[model samples]
Target chain A: MMKPGTRLKSAVCDAEIMIIKIAESADLSCGGQLMAEAPERTEGDGDRMHGCLIGKRYVNAEETIEVLCVKSGDGSLYYEGQELMTKDTKKLPSSD
Target chain B: MNIALLLQMAAEACPDRCALTHEGRHYTFSELFAAAQRAAHHFLAAEVKFVALMDVSSPAVPIALMGAAMSGVPYAPINYRLSEAQLTPLLDRISPAYLITGSEIVAEDRSGWVVRSSEEFMSVVSEGEISDLAWHDDPSAVAVQLFTSGTTGEPKAALLRHEHLVSYILGSVEFMGADEAEAALVSVPPYHIAGISAVMSNIYACRHIVQLPNFDPQVWLTLCAEQSVTSAFVVPTMLSRIIETLQQGAMATEALSSIKSIAYGGGKMPVPVIEHALALLPQVNFTNAYGLTETSSTITLLDPDDHRAALEQSDGPIRARLGSVGRPLPAVEIEIRDEHGAVLPPLEAGEIYVRGPQVSGEYEGRSVLDEAGWFPTRDAGYVDDEGYLFLSGRADDVIVRGGENISPGEIEDLLHQHSAISDVAAVGVPSEEWGETIALAVVTAAGQSITEDGLREHIRNHLRSSRVPELIQFVNELPYNETGKLLRREVRAWFAAEAA
Candidate 1:
């Protein structure tokens, strides 16, 4: 479920998936930096792992997983070069 | 002080007479005066410097405006039609203390403080008898600050004084032959100097003002008939649109029969449109007014007699004077000067300079007035032997391509003569080789078509190759500001974008 102000990322065409919490500092990272910061620890229930992965992405956790990555400006996570979750999954207020 | 005193005198002289009407509600002079007094007291309590008005023409406009003046606070009527980006710059510059609006508008966050609703201000004035408040009689005090359309740059606020306002009303009454009993159906927006001047003149003459929220051709026609409006003012663009509406049978001719004088300004009325309007309404008196915001709306008026006389002269003086804006009003002096500020000979085009009591000396933060007290109008025109002024176009609007000067109006006039062309604007676009190149944007007549090659050929046959537009673009409609004046900067931008 999309929560207000939560951040998510995915690359559906690339078959990749990622989720993250939005943070002010995370905004400076380009697509390369975000793709390189995939977390390593993947142990827990689905929801707990989800929160941990999102938190790791927000903090720029530098760990790699065995998934092809594609980059995009929209905050979408990708796995195996395919989008999994998008910025729309998070109910953030429009910057405009 | 004079305007406040005039209102008080008018109220006392004719308490029972209708002073203003808007949206089916009428206010007598006594009631309107009381409302203005109440608003004055409220402003006094707030101790604000300026009252910003944001609405179209309404009965509340005059009351709040006069009330602000009576309390010695300058009133600025901001054009509500301006985009947020445009409005921001003006709000930052003026920083008005209070905003007076009707129910239709939503106050933006940028407006620092606001006094909403004319009814709210009037209610406060009605709560107490503050009619005896001593009037501030400073002639030099800024009575109103009207913003220009900002077609070229950021809008400049033209500060008009109490004396200037009175002069405009008194002079226009004599020129327009307006009397105290005349009721004017006003359709011009309040933000424009012309609109405000029209309302103030009616008040100064102690005539009834029937205010429309905005210019609607159908509503304007109906009101003129229903209210028995004897006099009215509109820009040439509105006149053209009204004529089109009538031709389409959307409006009836009887609705326009009651109007005595229909004054037009803002731009030149094509000879054909003026002739058609005259033929359609023979009973109505038509006048073409020529002035700027800096001149309190109108400085010269080409009356119907001048129009007929110009047509009668076979030498094209009338057609030439159709390009001319007419002679200066009483107490005003106009001169044509060369680049060096030296006076030019008659019939020679140069910068038009105006000096008079009604003319504003300087703009806020900009000294346009020279040491000799003449303000360069930046308009290129010359006076003929008959003492009539003819405008070529704006001096800035003149294009210099390959070291040769070209007036866009000359090209526009030619395009207007084309049977298949409905409307046209010619602009000079930047070029690497020639510095500037001629470009034309045209709107075609209904059910008519023309190829670019054919248009170029047509132009080449009539004018020099250099004068013919190098580029032609067809558009559904030309971009115009709220007052119907072409947006030259916007047109240039559109051409640039298309080229890219």
Candidate 2:
């Protein structure tokens, strides 16, 4: 089980995800491929269809997990074999 | 995950953005990242167990902090203002460590440690190549070890794990949420939790930080205007001084107009100072952040909205909520319990206990967490019906007079509202009849005086007759630590001597 604050990378592509919430027995994947523990520089041909931009957050369908892309990649994020969607931006309260 | 990952993320996302500013010098996130990497290599070469900074805030602060985190070692920042007598014991505790210090503070005997001047340390770090970009991300690894200020007693080492700090940042702050032009001015001492928290939070939010090692009201104001500092955090005493400086027209209003928000904590803010600040700086947002080092900086913040609402609202109950420490963070849980440990209802004052992912509640060896994971904060407070937590004072500071538990904060707050009183502290002194009686030490406003009879009548009319102080003495000023915490222990001693 991936825990919140855990960083996952794709061995097949440049996709990276930071886990926001740990789901029980959820299959977290990227571009139809299982995600690995660290990022790979070389791009893979598993899925070249979607792109992940830096600073954009990707979330699962149930919204139980959210990840902000700190680095851009060619592969799209997936969970339970479904493509993750961009979450609407919510204004966070200022805490200094 | 290691807390260094926060800095790594910032460097990856905005490498060119300015990460830190000090004395007109600036370093980008990329430069800071590379510098930390180099410094980590130096630490590994020196075979040091910890990277300790016994100096003031500067570029070296972030460099050493991130370097220690990257090397999987604890980073400790010791108070530079402490005298040699007080500082020697602390240095002895962190032996076999790498100490980065300023030139003037270097001691003759440097046994069991490697000491490097800040300039020498920076130059050496810059000489090395940037390697080992990936740091060990073990969540259990200790990140920063801070010494408590020891206001009431001896200082203890409070440990903050990487997971604890990371959870606090992720739960309280948004990722890359700051505007590109936004900058924060940090004046709190590096040893204080507020100083450390400001650096991590601002870096994660991508906000540029300007450090002020020695706080002067003029320098702070000047830097705010020149840097266009949008945010700042100050202790209550600093805020009081700033408010006084600004109110005296010593600094231009235009200089301070650029400040969008200011957060004050690290001590209880007197009602008069905060009210005066609100009246003077109407444009700025005011936040009251309340937390302890054991809780990783801030578990509760009276946000800007709460500040504005309390000022605008007319209802007394609603307006008085201004004095509260706001509600607990979504990730933290707080309970008020009586002496026997029974949980108290809202509006009933009792000992404050907290449990959360970020609450370390730890020292070096002994864990303060109870069987149920609750850490007794040893602070007496209550939550209003609206869930706003109001702190009375430290449990040790409470006064017991003739078997009646009385909070000194209540009396102090009431007396502070008097027009002639500038500062006041209520301490319990030995009494012959009553076991202990409250003695009030007061500082009259500039060129102003109030008779002891007049003050006694004010307290009696405002509160019950039992609440009136038995002994009231006029003093020049009350003692306070550097971080703005009242030295109640010292105050009681002073009052005792005066009575004798």
Candidate 2 local lDDT, B1-500, one digit each (tens):
77887898899889999999999999999999889999988887778778899888888998899999998879999998888778878877777789898845557576657888888888877666677556776787889999999988888999999888987887788778898899999999888899888889998998999999999999999999999999999999999888888888999778987888898889898877888989888998888888999999888878878888898986586788778888888889999999999999999999999999899999986789999899999989999998899999999888889999999999988988888999999988989898899999899999888998999899999997888998888888889888899998888998788878
Listed in order, each prediction's TM-score against the native is: 0.79, 0.94
DockQ of each: 0.00, 0.43
Q: Quantify all predictions' global Cα lDDT against the true fold.
A: 0.68, 0.85
Q: What ranges in model 2 sit over 4 Å off?
A: A1-6, A18-27, A38-70, A82-92, B103-109
lDDT of 2 at B136: 73
| Model 2 chain B: worst 10 consecutive residues (lDDT sum) | B103-112
Report the lDDT tens digits of candidate 1 across residue range A4-38: 11222331111122222222233221222232233
Q: What is candidate 1's lDDT per residue for B179-274, written digit by digit as tens?
A: 456788777888888777876766655678888777888888889888888877787788888888888899888887667778888776766677
